[model samples]
Target: MTGGSGGHGGGRGGAVAAVDLGATSGRVMIGRLTDGIVSLEAVARFPNGPVPHADGLHWDFRALFEHIVTGLAEAVAREPQLASIGIDSWAVDYGLLRDGELLAEPFHYRDDRTEAGVDLVHALEPFDELYRRNGLQFLPFNTLYQFAVDAPVAEADTALLIPDLVAYLLTGARVAERTNASTTGLVDVAHASWDTALAERIGIPPTLLPDLVSPGTHLGRLTPELTARVGAPLDVVTVGSHDTASAVVAVPMADPATSAYISCGTWGLVGVELEQPLVTDAAREANFTNEGGVDGRVRFLHNVTGLWLLSETLRAWEDEDGAAIDLPALLDAAAGVDGPVPLFDANDPSLSAPGDMPARIAAVLRSAGAQAPVGRPAFVRAIIESIAQAFADAVHTAARLTGRRLETVHIVGGGSLNRPLCQATADRTGLPVLAGPVEATALGNVLVQGRALGWFGDDATLETLRATVAASVTPVGYEPRNGGTSL
Candidate 1:
């Protein structure tokens, strides 16, 4: 458990490619489902982040689209038998299109441009009522809020969330994958369809919405023009287009009803997967989101600010040092810190933006009557503990809201590799923490495609895919410490 191995692998059989995109990075991997083993082999990876524009923070969709095509082409070349491909990315940010052409670059969700949108929408329908209709947590950057103030959306004839946008460009298809579309706050919670009335009430054109599709549905093969460019005419399969939803699909939980999951990457999507949505007032009051899941399940989770804090803080310190810090060495040093380090609220709004993260975190600490961390080790310790604390809090709230005797916490995605953070979460939550399958998003994407290709047959449930995952990867285990909730 102290060490790990395998970022990509080499294998081939009933193969499919997964184009998994995160807020900060993107990768294309080939997944082979054979001999009861689901294996992944990396094809390509590229950097992704906010690109400052004259307007505000925006994603470089042009660059990302090129990278994705190149990656998929490389993947196809590597695995000639690759059956199909699926795409997934961070949710709630989208591109607008007019006459099948993008009107503008998609705004980064982190951009501080949604305040006006929030005000404008809540004026039409208060957040409480909106939640009743949509079941989305009140994120200022939810696509519905963004549409409230995005002038370009008024002119665009179609709106596509990130993965849908990528799929559309590749296949000439204009369908919104349901999992990601649910994050837009324009999908009805109870019905799992577009809330056209809500759109019109808020002054967004309903025509901009596209047909909704489910995971494992075949979107289309690459258009012939795209085929010549990408080197193949492979079909595009819809997975859980939302990255968190896909990550949840590969949680490796044998019994989801008794376990909670933290899809810990840029954000800690902490919650449980349920047969149906949990939309009680208590759930809404706790800021839990009832996002759509594959197989018509519900991702009843809350989004706690996650590893972005540590990543941004690292960026700040690296700037000051003029070199990249050794993350493992720093974390090892942090793990040896003697006692409880000063903790700050990990979900503080002031800490959300980019730049000077250490200063901003310290300022928050000082304002909260805690001593500022004196050195890098202590600072890192503080960061880990604070984030772990937030994760623990969210896990407890999810359990209480859902009325489950949560027996396990599954930490997947990049944060699962942080041994100290996982241990701290186990300690704080007083529950066993199971962590690994770091590429769960890609695995889920691949699993869905594999099923679509009949590798698991048509009746394979998310649980079946997850069981295959369990058989493939061994998750590291952490037991609760003697002093519960203490580092």
Candidate 2:
């Protein structure tokens, strides 16, 4: 990606398409910057989730690819001046390719198949050693753990993480975008490169991993077949390629160093940014991760499961009643509950897998000697409060672990719009919560593409991008009301 206004776009300022994928859903958005105001137009949205296979849960990559291609065509039809496409999704999950042919649809991270992989990986090299090498938190679904049991790795020539796999399909390029690669548990967190020795020691061939590229690197032009389908020749640029990385890129923080962020969606990633990896024993003990970021920064964060709890509870209730629940109204009713509510652990491992979430939560509540809430509204309140409690704990631990006061907290993505959760986090953490830009991941995806096309001019840094995001979208603020806010 160079600073030029030539080729199909032929302008320093033009639109870029961002394909942002999450666990439950995916969307395509068109973004452009004009006079420092970043704007986005959502072009398409498609449902996504675990598809059960004979062996385990997996993604329907073919279906997702069809959606993506159709979405790109829609975007190009709407905006013929589309300069590039950038993709991002949840990390760790991947597709194995042999001679550019997909071996199979990738397994879903929430699948129960990684149990033996954890044991096998730990047996070869214990977790603490792995932590010092990768600076990643102990997630059972990290790519290395998944690779331990994946038979496809033995036959595949390359393994691409979700977004990279999508890019490969669109542009026929094979390369790992660094930000997402950092979460795979095979990268040298300090050097920002793959630890091939560790990878081979753990059964993954280094050849299966492609050369890494930084965000904003030009991948390639869309394939001729894709070009004909989309009605234009567009380049593919590497954005963060990890949904959380993209979300953090668009966190319109007043000051990142003194502020903690909760990239709240499927997981509430809580932490502050650093210029260097923090791989200390204390950080490892706290299960804090130092993932790579755009412009070579460190995203020192902890993952606490987020919206999945409430979403699954709602799903179970809807299945039982065969009717959709009104979430806003339920949250409003929940806010009216007067006294303290029963709280359960949001980070409990048993609550991880998909199914009967309400029952699992109730079991955890009883295990903690707290009775389940009486009704639906109370149950929802308990869930939000419990999540808020987790957020507060992570934020406090982050502050202590990093030796930062962390005066302000910024909550971006879907959970930011949850007023009750935001208020509870503020009240619990004693820090004012700034929330908005619900489409931060897509926005960040666009911002990177925009900059790559010289839309922001030369010398534009991450701060410059943050300034643009703040100007484009304002955030809602929540202050602590009760005495519990004291740090």
Candidate 3:
């Protein structure tokens, strides 16, 4: 089965716009599908980050919305006959609305405000029981805890995930796209619906959440004002609104049965695809998450403190030296040096927030009774090595918890472009690594829109969608060096 012509006058080869928002940056891409081949071109790209204020760190939602509008206009200019638009972003953060007005800027998940709430939630509902109900990894920043820390304003009438809020801003439609909603820690893993009882216990109103809808649901036409502003009439369709969910949908797994993926970006989401949620004591003990995937699959994964470690370290260096470091050169230098470096747990809570990352890393090393790296290159190597080790641990845990034999590790997103990281992951896991489709999140966003518009036929399966992606992009492969697994 394949996508067929359904919307616009572009026949089956129409283009769709994807708004992919990340923690550090965001991009609007135009995905052109010809026959069964998909190609993507970035229309606009912009930096995105938290804004610190008197209270705490929060997203600059207004600026981000303006960027989205600008990107959509750019896409319209490039492809006047765009079929539709889909949006995806990091999960767990959301905007509150009262009488159709945004209440305030959404809090960034990394804000320390949730610390008190985390303890409160665990006290109310034991961690194991909560995990059994939601099957979610115990992330301190999950929406449930965030709400516990500071519940939405009483007047707020609706709560929308980041992507859903963006879509609402574009089309004046309000709906909770399921894939992203699953990350809230307030949804029932078995029923795929909001756990109203749980929400009430957490002091979040059931009325605040909008009706849940699945991926590929046509949200509606873009608002008339937006249409005129963008010079195109595009329907806003829901993809896997969670960026990781969209990335997983675009993972070109050659053999689904024996493949796992690391949607490596600011964070590394490492796990395997499962038909059902893995809600066992083992899974909880490993702190593995079961986020929703496209087509109702479970994204059974672990969130590893990913490139943020290196990125933060670099940021600290740039701030201290008053100059940007040449990343490629530093990586090359790190790769050339061979020696023993201390490995710290990347998931440590102390390293979660933005600050002096290099010093924090050294502190972790010192506390562990290990010598800290003396130079930037050595620090870079240590960070990368620590990330690789974490990835290996997650991969092994996913396999053991799910009883699957892993054969390949697919590293998608920006991290795929890092050769040293890819090679390190392969060496650490003792498994071949396939890395590419750097725009997996956007591709997945567009693919879901394509399918919903009947660009892909009704019979199109996830495999067919991935086949299109596989045929369109070539992946780079890395062979493992060591014979045994590092874990």
Candidate 4:
């Protein structure tokens, strides 16, 4: 199997289905590219969340898989011309397989089991060496730590990252996609392959790892069953399998040299795309990651705790009130508040789990000698302001560390629709902010598949695809105000 080979000049155009799985929800979007313009429509969307099992919080992978297949079927029903399929999702979390069967439900990254493993990993291999080898930040939920805690290799024949697992279910091809592999903390940054040495050091069998494939590699046609079920003989193409990686691919930057992007969703991945990995001691000290990007670029950024702050806080509020809280009303009330809001470290691990976020935030604020917000509105304001501050700090740190001057910050994904967050980030960073195309992950996924199907043309580059996005969608922008108030 291969990509579409016709050039753009040949009037080649088609639709591609993108399965974008986020932490809070999943969507199947169909992207149509014709005459160098792209358009996307959501065919299906379903809520996703952690399930509390006897052991701990675990992902409902079975439910998610069903939703993905449902989305694919809906996509084909909506657009009979759908050409290819691509899947992208949150990184690090994975499913173990034995004899090509998923062994058990995959653990949610927020599960507490990794804490002891984090300590053990550092004891076995110095943090510096891990960073130097993989260029991954020290996330307690990274696959390495998760593997350390779960120790699945003894009974597992294969480990596949979330998106790859979904892809495998569709096409029966078991391979690791590079973009997501970079987040596992088991890939050699320089070589862009599995770090077998590191895996062995951590007691993970090297053979358990799958062969690596770059984005846009054609896996094959969907299995006969899937094809017949979906009513479309679709070929599955590897994309920037990590959701953030796919989002970064569609960041419509006219000039990447002076632009930084915030892939704002459950996590605010704030960073610059660089030609090479920034693995210096400074990068390590700053806790920046060098996740792989399309075309072998590096997404050098900090994983700032993002909208999960607000969403989880709201969830806690609703749980206590036993009713759904209106988010727009809360944001409106938050925006109406006049004075400065208190700030807390959004990256605090205590706030990472799935309960009592608002209370945890209040405790952190009080510990910092800052009064907690008086009500839900104030709390919302605080979370938005804290996220904006984190974004500004990350953008500044990225520029300083990379020796580049940032002229603008682009916020993509669901958070791009967040007017308060966009404006606050601009005001704090003192740079113009561009926000839009809330479906960047899907756009990037489809664009890559489209290019492989030769929708863009043989000479098409990433920039070319981005230009199509720029033409396809209008973005809202915010300029820094108040001479950039201090965080």
lDDT of 1 by residue, 194-264 (tens): 99999999999899999998887787789898899878888888999999988998999978878889999
Comparing 1 and 3 on lDDT, the stronger one: 3
**Location of the lowest summed lDDT over 10 successive residues in candidate 4:** 1-10
- The CA lDDT of each predicted structure is 0.89, 0.91, 0.89, 0.89
TM per candidate = 0.96, 0.98, 0.97, 0.97
Per-residue lDDT of candidate 2, residues 268-306 (tens digit): 999889999999999999999999999999999999989
In model 4, the runs with Cα more than 4 Å from the true position are 1-11, 484-487
Error of 1 at 99 (Å): 0.9
Q: If both were scored by TM-score, which would come out higher, candidate 2 or candidate 4?
A: 2
Q: Give the clashing residue pairs of candidate 4, or none.
A: 4-452, 4-453
Tens-digit lDDT track of model 3 for 52-120: 978899999999999999999999998888888999999999998988999899999989998898999
Provide the lowest-lDDT 10-residue window in model 3: 1-10
Top lDDT hit: 2
Give the lDDT of residue 241 in candidate 3: 95
